[model samples]
Structure formats: structure tokens, C-alpha cells
Target: MSEILSAPAPQVGNAESWTRREILQQPETLRATQALLRARQAAIEAFLSPLLARNDLRIVLTGAGSSAFIGDSLAPWLSMVMGRSIEAIATTDIVSAPALHLRAGAPTLLVSFGRSGNSPESAAAVDLTEALVDSPHHLIITCNAEGDLARRAGANTHVVVLPDATHDRAFAMTSSFTAMMFAALSIFSGIATMEARAEVIAKALADTLMDADQRMAALVEHGFERVVYLGSGALKGLAREASLKLLELTAGALVTAFDTPLGFRHGPKSIVTDRTLIVVFVSNDPLTRRYDCDMIEELRAEARCGAVLAVSAQPMEGDALHIPHLEDAADADLLIPFILPAQLFGLHASLKLGLMPDTPSPSGTVNRVVQGVRIHAIGA
Candidate 1:
């Protein structure tokens, strides 16, 4: 841990790319996010207390693209902690089939995550939930203070606008994803509980950022054509986000996949090739860590893929990225630090491909704020 703390500062990269800056700014942004949340805890709890008291309230986490993955990563852990089933429904799915997803009779609390808060599906999902649920409450978490979602504060709604730095300028989300994710995790799990853990998490993130660039850059030099991200429990959702980061930053030049380490054996394991790179997010839970280790060892022994890397808080035998001072931390706390290497890898991969990391797609098919989305009326 002392070695990690004393590590030299990150090597500077292309000055023009906001992607690298946003990726590297996570430690600071996350601390800022937690500080803001701490200051607002009284009011936030006042707003959420009544709704949480009700036994029938249904909590739904919704977002689109990377924002959506935040819910995917958090839902399971939060559900267990809160002692209730929490739904992680993507805004894309909610907008398309409101009737199918929304329960008219259930009291609902929609926790919406948006970096820009302007995604058509994000607004549409909130609208659909409001219209479809007889009793609906909204907790809008957004990085954009001026976004449509942030302006949604009302008697039944509360909006948390994160620090401006988290409103990432890059096409793909880096800081925004982790910041928003930390906010949601802190909110649902209790801000004070996370207050104790936040600095440790941030330090681990700083350490990971310090060591990640060169390691990920070296991996990019291998020119692996495919990448797979695997994890379990809360980490499974993280695996999905990691896969998306590589895919988006590389502009889909590299084929990517994500699944639980155990689930990968069922069928997804077939995607591996000698040109493939597989990364496993090793869990901190004793039982889950065993399974994660088993998969990591299995993949390495198979020798089918070009490389297998384990990202772990605890030491492992083979190729691994070790995160410091979080060996006893909850798996949820691991999410932010665990994602650093993947985000760095994506940036390095984009540069290696001769593409701009800030805006990977040359064609206007994808935008910083998504385009070509037409929100339609429910019945029309």
C-alpha cells in the first residue's frame, strides 16, 4: 500500500484528448461527488425517507448506453443490501415497451442516471414511468446541471447534479460513469457508510491510474482482435461496462464480449481465439473470489487466448493488476478502481488504431449525445 501511494504521477498523454483527462480525473471527481453528496445528505434523505418507508415501493434504475450499465453494475448489490428486489431496466427497453416494464399499481421510485441528461430514451423512460405508475417518485442523478433531467425537481422528484468535471467532454463516458455510479451506490447504501470508504476507493483509483497507462498501452501493442471481460455478482455488470468501453473507444475495431466467469463456460467461451485478450474482474468475496480465480486459471491453462489478465484486490499467481488497500472492501467499492485499466486500455487502443480518443467514430452514426432517436407517443 505504501508503494502504491508513493508511485510516481501518471505520464502525460496527448493534450488534445479529453478522453484521457476524463479517465484520469476519476479519483478527484469521485471524491468531489462524495463530498457533494455528504453536504446534501440531510435534504436527500428527507426526500427519500418517506418513499423508502413504504414497503411496496418499487425502485427502478434506468439509463441508456454506458449510463444504463451503471444500473446493471449496481442493482444486484443494492438489492441485497436494501433487502428488496431492485430492477435495472435500461431506458432503451423502457421506452420501447412501457406497458410491459412499468407496473401501474406499484409505487415506484425511478432512479435515472444520465451523463448529458438529454438522451431521448432517458427522458422518455421517465415520462413513461410517471404516466404508467399510479404513484411515482423520481431521483434524477445527472452530471449535467442544465440537462432536462436536472430540471425535474418537484414535490415527487429530487435531482442530484454532480460536479461539472464529471460532465465528460469525450464521446465515450469515463469519469461520468464512475462518478454517477459512486453517487448512486452511496445514495442507496447510505452516504455515511460510503463516506468512510470513499477515500480508500479514490486512493485505489489514483494508484490504478498511475500504473495503468503503460500497462494497457503495452497490451494494445499486442494487437489482439478480440477482448472478453468477465466477473461475477456486482462485478458482472462491471464486466459489461468494461466490454463496452473497449468496443466504443476502438470504434468496434475489436470484437468484445462480457459475462460472469462461470457463465462464460456455458457458450461464450467459444469466442476466444489466439488473438483474443480476456480480462477477469476478480471478486473480493471469499466464495466468489474462488470462482473468479478458477476461471482465470482455467483460461490461462487453456492457452487458447493470447493473454488472460486478472484484475484483483488480493494478490493472484499470474498476470494481474493489483488494486491496493481494498482487500476487505465490499465488491461495490471495487467497481470504480476495477474499471480503470479497461478505460485506459480503450484509450490506448483508440490511439493505436490512429483514431481520436475523444471522438472515436469518424462517421456521425454515434454522437456524444446520441442522435436519430425519435421518442414516440405510447399509443400512437
Candidate 2:
């Protein structure tokens, strides 16, 4: 391991701390994540065994904010691997325009993600799906065991509670996002044995965790004024979460933006400057990775940005790339491994800027469940 790979891991919890201790320590969160995966698998096997057997089942993964992005990452892989049609739809849009998003009579499986599970939109979307669609089944994945969504799940719904620690105490979600994403991947892997997937997932996670433990301190110390995250295809949502992590963790001291690789050159590239830190999520797919590599190389040569970092699985052949993927590593779901870097980056940035990583927002401007938005009924 390089010097950058041996930094002290964040401590998880203690008696003195309320908010901050929750995420810095990993044991509880990791356990919770693993439990959530098991529960999700059980729920899917119980509810979806027969439905998935049918070819006409249309799977719709839905949520808001980080929750919504969980769907984006898993949709493509699940669609191809399981031979079922899957799409990620945002709950906000689903609430505002249910007819446009929901089909009238399709056998739809709406998989929802949430940290608190109490978000107004989450509940409303489920209600809307029932009203607008014929015979819909729901799979609710949430961190808050006592949340309304979990309580509302009846015989018709399959509800799985994520590990309690996944109900993050911080303003931004660190463990919850990755845990829910992993749960989604596990549920999709019903086509294969869960234990086999777990073996690969465990190896990938351990490696990333060890790498993040080392590199985070330096990335935070570099202290760029702004950060830009770039990804292509399904990764655009991960890019969004990565950008949001920095912004929220630092309480807006660090401005952030996200764009797809090809999308950036059109106009978003203007955001890159000497004080900006650019982090690119290289695609596993060869074609997409080529464009991602091209953009990073161009930026590195421009000397316009403070730093250009590639969080990649495959090593980039230069001094600039940060390769967390280990040699002889077992192949696993891509989303499982890529999330650790983003999680650690947010934690380090939060701590470096003197904001409590657990409670970045002391005044509660942003919250676990977003507040102050009234839910209005829409017309039929």
C-alpha cells in the first residue's frame, strides 16, 4: 500500500458524540448494510419469484435525491442480467405527473429507497401508483425501521428494513446511500446465488475501504475551492451524489457541479478552473471509458484545474490516477466498489472544513427527511 493508502480509518461512534460518531465508525453501518441486503433478498424471493417468472413484468425503481440515484445505478445491469425491463423514475416527477410515468395496467414492481422513509413524496408516490395502475407490487428499502413507509407495508407489500445505523445521524447520507445501492444490487442478483455475489462484493468493499482509509486525508488537505464530478450513462446519478456530498458535507464552503463526459465539453467545462477539483468516474464499458479518459487527459494537459483525479477500477497509466481496485480482485457489481471513494471524500471534506461530518448542518437548514414542502393533491 502507498503512504496515501494507510491513513487512519474514521472512527464510528462513542459515548460523547451524538451525530458525528455515527458514520465515522464503520462496523455498525457495515453490519446494517449487510443485514439490509439479506432482508431485501428475502423480500424479493417471497414477492417477486412468481412475478419475475413472467416476461411482461416492468420493474420501476423509484426514490428521491440520493434514493433516486440508487435506481439509476442498478437499472441497466438488472435489465440486462435478469431479462426484465427496469427504469429509474424520480418520485418527485412521479408525484407531479403520475400519468406520464405510471402505466395503467402493467404488472409493475416499484422498488423505493429512503433513509427516513417518511418523505411525503415517497408515500404519495406509492399511493398514486395504486390509484393509477392496476395491481402494483412495492418493495420498500429504508433505513428507518419505524418510518411510516415501513409501517404502511401490508400483506401486499414487501418491506425490508435497512440496518439501523443506515438511518444516518448526519445531514448527508453516507452509509445509507451505499447500503441501499448494495441492497438493490443484491435483490437484482436473484438470478444468481446471493452468497456468490457476497463473496465478490465483500472483497471489493474491503479493498475500497482500506484505500479510502489512506487517501482521504490528502484529498481533503488539497483544499480546492470547488469540485466537479463527471460520469457517463448510468453513472451520471453517481456523479450527482458525489457533487452533493461535497456541497453538503462542507456546508457549501465548497461549490460543486456534475456533468456527463460528453455533456461537459458542450458548456459545463467552463466550470473547471485553477481552483477547481475534477473527479471523473471512469466507465467499465470500453466506449464510455474512452470518452471519460479523453476528458481527463485534456484537463490534465490544460493545467487549468487544481487537480484531476480518476476514481477508476482499471488503472490509468499515469501519476494522476487513483486506482483502488486491487490486483487479482474478484469481479463484482461496479456500483458496490465505486461508492467508497465518494463516501470517504465527503467525510474528509466535512472534517477538514471543521464541519461535523455527522451533523454538517447544525441549524437544520437541510435534514434527514427534507422539511417545509407541502404536498398538494393533483387532479385525476
Candidate 3:
């Protein structure tokens, strides 16, 4: 862990950019995040123990943009572990139509993820849940201690404010996203349970960061006009976040698409062209891996795309970036390491386009905390 902590930042674009620092500081941030969770284990359990006892408790994970994708990535895995159907609904969706997504009869737990925790929809969604649900508990996981979500702590709410460093200064999320996702996963899965696994996960992420920058930089040289990210199950959510990272960092300079490996064959495969770069996030599950590998082979066999790259924990045959020490890890653990290549590629691509990775959007159309969202009253 010291090696990762002391490793020099990758020389991508302006070395002093917050984007690069946030992206590179993940190894340290992850360790710090878990350590905080471990220290707060008693209080966390105190808050959650009684909630877990309810047979009819409805658990909903919500957020916006990159934050929303955190729930997308973890909902399925958490559902399996908790033995209940957990819902991953975006704050935007709930704020828009609370009736469709929330139930007033059921006792509910709303798990919200936010980096800045100031997004209009974030607080609005929580307000709507409190107004509509019969019995609602709030678990606000955010990087910002000063953000609105953290201030919502009360009798019915518990807030987990992450380390200040995770409150990303860059326009796009890198470490903030991973840290909040890890926090929610740790809280739900048991902090102590993750203690044994955290070191390997951090080490694997460090290895990927150390090894991926040059490769990602070279990949950016290809200048593919479009990119597609594919995965299965939990990895499918990761593919979505990966796609968003590229789109946001590149500022829409490169068209990007994301879908499950099997779903891509249905219609999305048509997006692949001679100038398209297709990257697959291969699953570690033996059954799911075969399907993911099949897609990789099929795309390669067709030879229509610019290139096909696989990011996998398992050893791959060709054209893949293999993450070390996670070959047998659960797909949930693979999420953080698996995202390194995409993050690096996004950073390098921004640098390649002469755009500041810290603020890729030149116009005021996009913002770090997001803008132009007006949270209307429920009946408005």
C-alpha cells in the first residue's frame, strides 16, 4: 500500500490537474474510505440492524449522473447478498414522478450516492421519499461534508461523509465515484467482511493505474470516431459508467455506446464500424465469462471494428488488459480495478483533443455539480 501511496502521478496532460490527481489518488482514497468504515462499524450496524430485521423493508438506491451509475453498478450485487430485491432508481426519475417509484405503504430505506451531494435532484428525491413513504430511513453516502445531503442527518437519517479528498475538484468523477460506491457496498455487505478483501482490491487498482497510463495513451492515438463498452450482469452497470466517463471527458468529441455483451448482438452491434473501438468488461463468473468472451471473439472475427479490447480479471487470450490479483475475486470487487483503463483512456483522450481534463466542457452547457435542474413541487 505504501508503494501505491508514494507512486508518482502519471504524466497525462497537465500533471497538476485535479482530474489527474483524483484519478491517480484512488489507491489511497480506497484504503482511507474502508478504514473510516471500519472505525464507524458499530454506529453503522446500530443504524442498520433493526432495518434489516424488517421482512418487508424496501431498499432503494438513488443518485444522479455518475452518482446514479453507482447504484446501477451495485444494486444487483447488493440484492443477492441481502436476499431481497433492491431497487436502483435515479434521483431524477423519482423527482420527476415520485408516485411511480415510491410506495407509501412499505417501510423503505433510501440509499443515496452523491459526490458533491448538492445536486438539486438529490435533496428533492429525499424530500419526496419522506413526504410519500409511510416509514422511510435515509442512508446518505456522500464525499462532501458540507453538501446538503450530509446536513440532512436526523432521527430518521444517517449520513456517512467520506474523506474530504474524495470530494473531487474536477468536473468529472473519478475517485469520488469509486469511494462512494465502495462505502455503500461496505455498509451493506458488512464493513468487517470487506476488511480482508480491501488490501487486494486496492493493490489490484494500484497495479492497473501503474500499468495502464501508457497503454491508454497509445490507445488514444488511434483516434477512433466512436467507442462501445460491453459487459454482463454487474459488469453491465460498469460498462455504462465507463461509457459516461469517455463521453464526459471527451466532451462528446467521441460517440460512445454501452450494453450487455448479449444485448449488443440484438441491435446495438450495428454501432460497430471500421472506426469504432469496442471494449468488453469480461465477467469472472465462469458462465458469464464465456458469453463475454464469445462477443470478443465474434467482434474480432468480423474484423469490422477499429479494435476490440477486453478488460478482464481472468487471463485473456488476446487484445485484453488483465487486472492482476483479482482473477478469482467477485465481480463486485472487480468494478474498481476494471474501471482504471477506461478512466485512463478518458484522461488521455481529453489530453489528445487538447482539452483540459479538469474542465473538458468549454461551454457552460455542462458543470461539475450540474446546472439547469429546477426541482419542482410534487404536484407542479
Candidate 1: deviation at residue 262, Å? 0.9
TM-score-sorted candidate list, best first: 3, 1, 2
- Superposed model 1: Cα runs more than 4 Å off: 1-16
* TM-score per candidate, chains pooled: 0.96, 0.86, 0.96
User: Candidate 1 or 3, higher TM-score?
Assistant: 3
Q: Could you tell me which residue pairs clash in candidate 2?
A: 7-214, 11-24, 11-25, 12-25
Q: By lDDT, highest first, what's the ranking?
A: 1, 3, 2
lDDT of each: 0.91, 0.73, 0.90
User: How many residue pairs clash in each candidate at the backbone level?
Assistant: 0, 4, 0
Residues 1-380 of candidate 1: C-alpha lDDT, one tens digit per residue: 23322335434465336887788778889889999999999999999999999999999999998999999999999999999999999999999988889999999999999999999998898888888899989999999999999888579999999988889888889999999999999999899988879999998988877777889999999999999999999999999999999989888999999999999999999999999999999999999999998998888888999999999999878899999999999999999999999999998999889988887898868889988999899778
* Span of 10 residues, lowest total lDDT, candidate 3: 1-10
Candidate 2, 263-374: lDDT as tens digits: 9999888887788888888877777789999988998888999888887777777534344543333223555556567767777787777777666776878877888767
**Candidate 2 local distance difference test against the native:** 0.73
lDDT of 3 by residue, 55-105 (tens): 999999999998999899999999998899999999999999898999999
**Stretches of candidate 3 exceeding 4 Å from the true structure:** 1-16
Query: Clashes in candidate 2: how many?
Result: 4
